[model samples]
Target chain A: MSGHMEITLNGQTKNIPGNASLQALAEQYTKEPTRVVAELDGAIITRDAWSRTILKAGSKVELVSFVGGG
Target chain B: MPPIAHQTAQDSFELGGKIFSSRFLLGTGKFRNKGELKASILSSNARIVTVALRRIDLERHDENILEYIPDGVTLLTNTSGARTADEAIRIARLARASGQGDWIKVEVINDSKYLLPDNEETIKATKALTAEGFIVLPYISPDLYVARRLVEAGATAIMPLGSFIGSNMGLRTREFIQVLINEIRVPMIVDAGIGAPSHACEAMEIGAAAVLVNTAVAIADNPPMMAKAFAQAVEAGRAAYLSGLPAKRPQGEASSPLTGFLFE
Candidate 1:
């Protein structure tokens, strides 16, 4: 079903389209899609493969970006 | 142009197959604003700066740090939130996948209160990451054995804490870090607890290959100016180290004869 499904994103549960890909979720989160790294479950979804990696119900997603740090 | 005396010729800092001249590696965190961060970076003239990765805030939009960082500076992405070797490696991979360069600063800290790095986990991450063709710089607590192991794990450098991170306490671990500087083959870049330009100078004076400063510069009222001070201090200390510091003496040697006065 292409209806909304709940997935854990950056620790909070979010409802997204069941057919949404990792790419879509990342683009919706960050303006700079090139600098965003998305992980499905525990595996890193590389930029090239983000569009093809579909999200599932209850799938854990982590979106990370680099920031100022020492 | 006149050449400055005591300058070490061909002393380019070669790390991970890249060359950087400045020994002051700035940490780009805790800045009041992105403009200040950019100004500090330019004023510091730091060729290598450290950055950390974190989960993107889902609720609020924040400025992109990459836009502030000027081009040509090497980005040393740090694994700060990692509590284990595996977690650190995962962060490193994600950073690389995001087009951040391969230079990873392996920081595995399990302690919440003191925030001291876990040397064992750091070494494990270094070994794994280096084997994966990464240029790893592992942060540790300045143990001689641990440093040797990190180098053996193919670490490009070992960043021993001068003191606790962001303590502004300065080189409390001077003696231990000195041991690493003397023994470790890779560059011994003193990291953490460097509060002021003087601290950076002191670390360099003790033969430290480089130093990484964050909170000190970031918290300064005039960050860009403070960064320039740190840059100058690093250079001054490097000059003193290269010029061969004088030996300590128990007895004072008089510069002039005691009988040279008019009374004589």
Candidate 2:
């Protein structure tokens, strides 16, 4: 059996492993995991739970980062 | 009457079909608390105050700052976080939806360090906002050409900063701003970097239709007292402009006339 999940990051939608947590995905994709903050369905997620929080088939997530430039 | 004197006395600016009573626009930021903010606003006699749109804490109903603002004060919602023209346009719509205000302070800052307005994005946003029937007042640097461009793009008024945002530099671009005042047909409001009431007065004396101050008044030892000082300075500046200042002379001349050869 194959598990697949759809997530939107920074306005772009992509398919990833369904069982993986947001933290693992963030660690794998982002260069600096600590600098990014994510909101799951409009609710802010704490940094510690990003990896443990399981994702469903379709979840809307927004990643906000503090950029240096104005 | 001298031309300079006649020109200096003109006060008030027409924007969004309303006349602003005071030439000093206030910002609702950096105050010790909401009560102080209200007091300062009242003391300043500023009819217009700028507010930023942010997610309200729904749980705490009493903590909202909006309730503290007194009635009859016009709140100008600013797009302080928007980095692009499109984002600013969206924020304006959201502000209108939330019943903040129809007037928008378009602030497109692409750089976080300086918080300078992105000229390209600002112009784009101004054009779009004006087209959407929103009153656009863009916060821009003291660039004479950019001020003219914004004015042409249907902005209600051109708000040129006196210096870098939050720098408290106090009219560092006096010469350039003076040029903008002389050239731009619309109301020229000097926004940002005003550290004192004297700075506000200086802006007014130099033909700025109004001056918007936030940090100076907000972070003062006594916000209310500072607001009062600003109000008086603004009024004094306006009065001086209207009364007409004496022509600058290289040296003091005797009013009694030292040389009476013609009469003799």
Candidate 3:
């Protein structure tokens, strides 16, 4: 449990350290994580706090971006 | 006041403290490609363009739509997929976090068949977003009461639908929209279901602050050309409206007097 932790990111299960920062997880998932808005569980974690926001075990995270829409 | 033959640069529309000379708002969606999107926008001379928020596709990084948007043009991110107030609020915050400015087009549509905007959710999202310092432009179904509620909710502008979204059916709710235009003090933008340049012109002629067109221009045989036509049509309609349309006559009124016609 100390070495690896399981979290759901964008509904996909991933194993990272319990103390992994949100920034690390974002970078791992998308090339443009800076442009993404991350929501941890039900609350939004702003970009400035990504480095300090730690992912806990069984956390539900969602990353979204801007695309073409009318 | 009579409509001027020429509208100077001073004639501009202000939204959320921003002044825009062009009254046309473009939607950057459904283009065949990035090049086409850029060309159509430029041709239309629309200063404000709308985009949507979605989950980034990790596999298709090259398909990122933001790269295609040019500099100097303002981007209005729309909450097109949000079916509830919370979802739309989240999308608006995410859009602002992307450094795309605080302009948000709140669209909460739960109905799929008509693709109508949910006025109740839209009002909630508008109030929430605007309170957080975002400029909210809520797209509603062109109801007088709903529009007033949105304004009370601090919406910067009210974008009432002409008909179903992307239906290209023209202004099916023209009468209701006219009512909103007359009652609402803020800018009244006609969004969605505008199929042709004529439709856009009609909306403008009826005193719409602006018209947001997408499918008509994006899916045209020549998007850039269609965009140009729409731009011209919008201007013409606005000018005609300003010039004050001639009063209608119930009976047949001939250009020449009836007594002097053939008898002379």
Candidate 4:
């Protein structure tokens, strides 16, 4: 329990390793992390700062990318 | 020494301090394939393209929309899923964080039946986004009052719907859109409801600076060809407008002189 924690990701609850950074979470979902924008709670975390921004238990994260639209 | 004369340049589709020769603003949606989308964009020669931001499709990891768009094209991110000004603002900020340009099409719609834009909310979102130095384009009903308010709120362009979004209704509010084109100072990029190349042409013929389209081209049997057709129609319409389409006459006026006719 000490090495893992639950966090809300894209509106779904998920268990991630404890002390994981945003970059780590992003990599878990995408190989091209540079093409996404991460929103931690309500603030935008740019790709450059993702590696240093650590996630805490109960942290909410939303990773968004461009898609076809009108 | 001979005196030098300066030549002034004009850009027909200028928006957000950038000049684009093509008057077609294409939406990257509903394409059957990425290759066709890319081909359509290339054929249309649209300098400004729109994209929506959403959670990445985890299953389609092999494809990315951004990869389909070529370089040097401006991405005008649209807030499609937003139902309020605050939601639109949130989308705009996230789009900017992607390191793409700050051009956003603010679409605040609470209605589900028609997908008609809420004019008041669009104006509100435009004001907030423009203040943050984002090049905002607010989509709304073709109301003169709403247009004036949006322009005052710092919107770079006013995108009045020609009909309902994706309805392909073909300029149902033609007269209303003409009002904005005639009265509003900012560029009127007619958006939505355009279904055919001729529909896009009609909007341009009435003096629209540009038009954004998605459904017509995307749903065509051949998307790239259809995109080309729309692009050509837009250009032809612009040309007709520039050349001054003959004034409508209540009665017929013969092109040939009455006295010059040999049969007479």
CAPRI verdict (incorrect, acceptable, medium, high) for model 3: medium
lDDT of 1 by residue, A1-70 (tens): 4599999999999999988999899889888878788888898888899889999899999998989999
* lDDT, each prediction: 0.91, 0.77, 0.88, 0.91
User: How good is the docking of model 2, by CAPRI class?
Assistant: incorrect
Report the C-alpha lDDT of model 4 over A1-70, residue by residue, as the tens digit. Answer: 8899999888888899999999999999887888999999999998889999999999999989999999
Task: List ranges where model 2 is wrong by over 4 Å.
Answer: A1-70, B1-12, B57-62, B255-264
Q: DockQ for each candidate?
A: 0.88, 0.04, 0.67, 0.85
- RMSD to true structure for each model, in Å: 1.9, 9.3, 2.6, 3.3
lDDT of 1 by residue, B1-264 (tens): 887754655667788898887888999999999899999999999989999999999988778999998999999999999999999999999989988789999999999888999999999999999999999999999999999898889999999999999899999999999998888789899999999899999999999988899999999999999999998999999889888899889999987987869976
Higher-DockQ candidate of 2 and 4 = 4
Q: Estimate each model's TM-score.
A: 0.96, 0.74, 0.92, 0.95
* Over 4 Å off, model 3: B1-5, B256-263
Better of 2 and 4 by TM-score: 4
Report how far off residue A31 is in candidate 4 (Å): 1.5
Candidate 2 lDDT over B81-180, as tens digits, reads 8999998887677666544568988999988888888988999999999988899999888787888788888998888888888888899989988898
The candidate with the higher DockQ, 1 or 4, is 1
Tens-digit lDDT string for candidate 3 (A1-70): 5789999887888889779999998898788777788889978888899999999899999888877788
Report how far residue B49 has shifted in candidate 1, in Å: 0.8
**Candidate 4 chain B — worst ten consecutive residues by lDDT sum?**
B3-12
